[model samples]
Target chain A: MLAKRIIPCLDIKDGRTVKGVNFEGLRDAGDPVELARRYAKEGADELVFLDITATKEKRKTLVKLVEKIALELDIPFTVGGGIGSVEEIADLLHAGADKVSLNSAIVRNPDLINEASRQFGSQCIVAAVDAKSQGDQWEVFISGGSKNTGKNALKWIKEVEERGAGEILLTSMDRDGTKSGFDLELLSAVNDITSIPVIASGGAGTSQHCIDAIKKAKADAVLAASIFHFQEIEIHDLKEKLKNADIPVRETI
Target chain B: MIAIINYEAGNLASVSNALQRLTIPHTITNKESELDKADGIIFPGVGHATPAMASLRENGLDSWLKQTTKPVLGICLGMQLFYESSEEGDSEGLGVIPGRLKKFDSSQHKVPHMGWNTFSDVNAHPLVKGFGTEEYFYYVHSYYAPENEFTTASCHYINEFSSVVCRDNYMGVQFHPEKSGKEGSLLLQNFIQIVSSE
Candidate 1:
């Protein structure tokens, strides 16, 4: 049986791990390499490092950090943020990242998804869709959720799958950092429309929220930041709760 | 030393990094001469079988892999390439193992079968010495080799599939041990032990 994955997303800026509440106020968490090692030890199924700095000048530091993290971390990890070209994606993968997540770059040039997937294989290309509720529908937001693309979230998800993205990291801008819970309705809607694996992100306050994301929305994985970063919820204890809820989670001991 | 076969298969770095962390001596090489100097070979791959096979043949690794007497372990697409053929691009394999690879029925289950899944029926083999049914390994693939005579261990998703396949001198795992955490590291360590024993 495929266990439901529990991921700890480390938002990286200036090579340090930081968590933003609603993508605005940045709070220092800890060192990325140290946190990554701790999370792996705590039984995180996978790790995602989003380089929030994502500047052309900062690309070198991100690559170096990725190489360092890959040296210490054993589980599969993803590196994203300002990954525009196939060359950048190649550099990250070559640096030992198991996968690379693309956001604004892919939205601007959707063909990059096709070309990157074709060149690196879809297994390594992840399409991260950040969305927020507008009226009755969810609209895609890019550039760290600062700009709304006005694209229907559901339709864009289907397009991304068709473009050969192996996985979709669907984050709810409305739920991110709120710690209330994941946007279940949005997640389920995206889940229904796409066949590729959907990773539910944002609004993870408690273990029940994680369970709801998995059981209610049918998310293959759940990614949270502050909860794990602050020790508010220990991954092992959360997996215990998830296991008690009959959700298949990897062993955490 | 373990020589990781580098046929332009996308994931040589992670495998080499894993071995380096384990403090195991290894090298990534496409040359037959380098492979000849190693005691074991790790064939790491992640991509479509067609292009992977094309690269293998282009580098003349298909014949070398077929004739190599040293212990060989293939990961993911590398394992799929050990079979007779794959439905993915209708590509032919090295034929070290019988049968062909089939795509999972997406109508019934997820296409890629990603994430941690446990394997059962783990026959007593050196490569899987301490692995049990409860252990989980990281997997990400669309095509799977069905359970067959060469299957040493199997996993179930939509259907029972060969997760670990082995025969004399050759072993293949559909999961990425290099990225499977502690248990994954243990599997690599076990492989090195097997190489040492041989």
Candidate 2:
């Protein structure tokens, strides 16, 4: 059986990693490459480098940073934020990113997903969706959970999968930084609708939270920030807990 | 110099970068003349099988690659292309390894077997030198070649599929050693050391 992945996401800004509460009020974590190497050694399944700085200056910095990380780290990594075109994705991939994640760009132009999957292969394109619950529905949010798209979460996921998005990274804005756990209902809703691998993000505060997301939400992978970045929980320990829960994990050295 | 046969496949950068990290000198080219100067060849590809084989034939790399006696390694699609044929486009392969690549029946498991999977104990080979039997390597492929006499390592995806195959100077891995973290880099390092010693 395929192992459930435990991923630590580093929100990079201007070549430095920044972590905030609920995606706001950023604080410095450490050098992106150094932090990535540490996590890789600590038994993280993968690393996600999200370039929170949307400016052109920061984008170039992120590309260079990714190159640096690739040189040092031996684990799989993903680069996202401000990736708008095929050429940009190509640049990131060429810089040593295993996958290029599309969020805002895909919302503005869904066709980019099809074009990117065609040019780069669907396995490398991950569609990241930020969702917040509104009454009885989970609505898709864009621009790092700042704007509502008025689109149904499940509907958009199916559309993106049809558009050739290889995987879906669903983050719950409501649960993010709450330290409560994942939004199980929202995760289940999206997981029920798509066949592509789903990476559950946001609101992971403990090892049990990760286990719950996989067993209850039925997610293929789990991603966290504060828990990992703040060292509240080490990746190896969390993976051990998940292993005890019968969730498959890569054996640690 | 080592040659990485380039035909517009995914993860070329990672492969080249891995080689660079190990400080191994290499070149990426499709030109036959440059390929001939190389002591070893690495055929790396990530895409559908039919067109990948077509691209090789279109570029006339098929004939050029067949004549190479130097150590040759194929990763993912590169491995599939070494087979006699593939069900992807019902396309014929390089026939360097005697087998047929077929699609994984989704009914049994899943298609496009992705992520990391473990490799069984490997016989004493230069490529498997530093790596252990239980070491996991990254893999992403829709079609896989059935295990045959050439299989050097096996991985069970629904059922056992050929993970690594070796015959004479030729080698093939359905998994992507370039992208597969430490174990993967060590494998590449072993390949470089083998080539350098030769």
Candidate 3:
């Protein structure tokens, strides 16, 4: 059986993790390498690094940092943010990123997804969708969730999947960072439509919230940031809880 | 030393990255001579079989690999290329292993078996030695090589597919051990151990 995945997302800036991750035993908590090592050790099914670096030179630093993370962590690591071109995506993959996520860039040129998937295999391309609820349906947002594309979220998912996206990273903008819980209604709506795996992101506060996202919402994977960055929920304990709940997760200990 | 074959199939960094952590000296090369320098070869691929096989042939790696007696481990598309042929694009394999690649029935199961999945029916080969009997390895693929005489381990996703296939001088895995967490690292360590013994 395929184990439900628990992923920790970390934002990178200036070649360092944006969130002040301070897990004990980690010599450098803010360092992406150390934090990634801890997450892998604690049984994170996967890790996603959103390179929020702004400067052109710092982007090079992010690439170097990606190679370092690859050397340090053995789990699947995904790099996203500011990846707009095939050349850039190739650089990250060559730097040892298992997969690359595309958001605004994918929308800007949907052909990019087709071309990338053709070059790197659909398995390595992740289509991340940032969406917000509007009336009954959801609207897709781009530019770091600041602008609504007006394209229906559910409709976009079908397009990306058909366009050869292997997986969908669905984030609920309204629920992001709320700590209330994942938008189950939004997640379920996406899950119900797509055959490809759906990763539910945003609004993860409690460990139980993750469990519910899986059992109730039928998410193939759950991705959270603050909950993991602040150590609000230790990955090891969370995995234990998920295991006890019969969710079939990897054993960290 | 291990030579990670470079045929422009995709990135060779992940394979090299895992070897670096294991303290295993390795190099990424496409030259036919560089392959003989290493005790073992790790063939990694990430694209369609048609173009991948094309690159291998262009570099004469197809013939070199078919003739090499040293341990050659194939990953993902690399593994599919070890068999006689793949249904994907009607591509020809290295013919190192006698099996046919089959695409997962999307009607019954997901086309690409993505995420962490457990391996079962593991054979007592050095490749799987000292590893936990039950473990999950990261995998993402729409096609898989079915079990045959070279079958070492099997994993169930949509159905029972050959997870690990091994024959004389060649072993292949459908999953990315480099990205499979602790268990994957252990598997790579075991591969290194296999190379050292040879």
Candidate 4:
């Protein structure tokens, strides 16, 4: 049986990790590579680096940061944000990223996901969907969860999966930065339809919240930002709680 | 020097990075002459069986690999390719080991048998040096080679499959040591030491 994964998501800007309130009002966390190395030592199943900066300088910095992290850490890591082409993914993989995630690019040209997966294996490609409830349906949002794509979240997920995406990272824009709990409804909706491993992101307040998301949402993995970044909950203790709750976790040394 | 056979599969970087972290000299090459010059060869691959085998044949690496007297370590698809045949594409393997790879019966468990699985040590082998009798290793595969005479370690997904198999100079593991964390790196280090000693 596959152990449930615990992931720490780092929001990067200009090669530094920053966390914001509601995806704005950013505060510097630390150097991205240093933070990544710490997380890997703390037994984080994986690390996700999302470059929030859209500038060319920051993008170049991100590539070097990824190289630094790849050199230091042995665990799997993913790099996302402003990635637009297969060549960019190839470059990132060459630099050290285990998987490359697509957001806005996939919304603009859905074929990129399929073509990438066809060229690279599906396992190397991750489709990230930002969803928010619009009336009765959850709509997909792009550009760091600021703009709505006007596409149905569930439908888009199915399309991407059909296009050969190996996994789906579902983040709830409404629940993001709230730290209340995961968007269980959103998770349930996507989990009900897709067989691909779903990574539940955003709104993880307490260790119990992580447990609820995995057990109720049926997520293969849970990703959190604020709680972990602020040291509100230590990753090892959280994994211990989850392990006691019968959730399979990688043992911490 | 260690040679990682490149057959258009993923995870080569992870393997090379592991070797570099340990300060072990290695070269990534698909060419026959470079592989022949290496003291040991690490055949690392990830993907379906058919195309992987085809790529090996297309590059003329399959035959060249068989002629080498150096120790060879195959990971994941590289391990399956050591078998006689695979059910993945109903394709033939290198036949280095006398066994057939078959898909796990999903009715008993899930397909793609992803994540950490424990291997019951059947015999002591240099490649698995520091590993305990029941050590867990990361695995991600749908088809597995059934238990056979050469099997050195066994793991159960739906039923027992050959987790590690050893023969004269050939050894293969059905797990990704490059991605399996500390214990995994230790195993790779052990393999490196074994090759160095040889």
DockQ of all predictions against the true structure, Cα-based: 0.86, 0.52, 0.76, 0.45
The TM-score of predicted model 4 comes to 0.91
TM of chain B, each: 0.98, 0.95, 0.97, 0.96
Candidate 1 segments exceeding 4 Å error = A20-29
TM-score between candidate 3 chain A and the true chain A: 0.97
lDDT of 2 by residue, A49-103 (tens): 8988866687678778888888787778889987999999988988888898999
lDDT of each: 0.91, 0.83, 0.88, 0.83
Candidate 3 per-residue lDDT, tens place, B1-198, comes to: 899999878458888888887788999899988998889999988879999999999999999999999998899889889999999998888888887898888876455788888876787899988755468888989999888878899988778889898998898999998888778888888888899899
Which should have the higher lDDT, number 1 or number 3? 1
Q: Is candidate 3 or candidate 4 better by TM-score?
A: 3
At residue B137, give the lDDT of candidate 4.
Answer: 73
lDDT of 3 by residue, A121-172 (tens): 9988999999999988899999998898999999999999999999999999
Query: Candidate 2: misplaced stretches above 4 Å?
Result: A20-29, B107-111, B120-124, B130-133
Best prediction by lDDT: 1
Query: lDDT tens string, model 2, B1-198?
Result: 999988877467778888887788999998999998998899998767766777888889999878778888888888888889988778899998887888787565434576777876466677787665567777777788898888888888777888888888888888888767778888887777777777
Worst 10 residues of 2 chain B by lDDT: B106-115
Question: Clashing residue pairs in candidate 1, if any?
Answer: none
Please give me the DockQ of candidate 4 compared with the native complex.
0.45
Q: What would the DockQ be for model 2?
A: 0.52
A-chain TM-score in candidate 2?
0.94
Clashing pairs in model 4, backbone N/Cα/C closer than 3 A: none
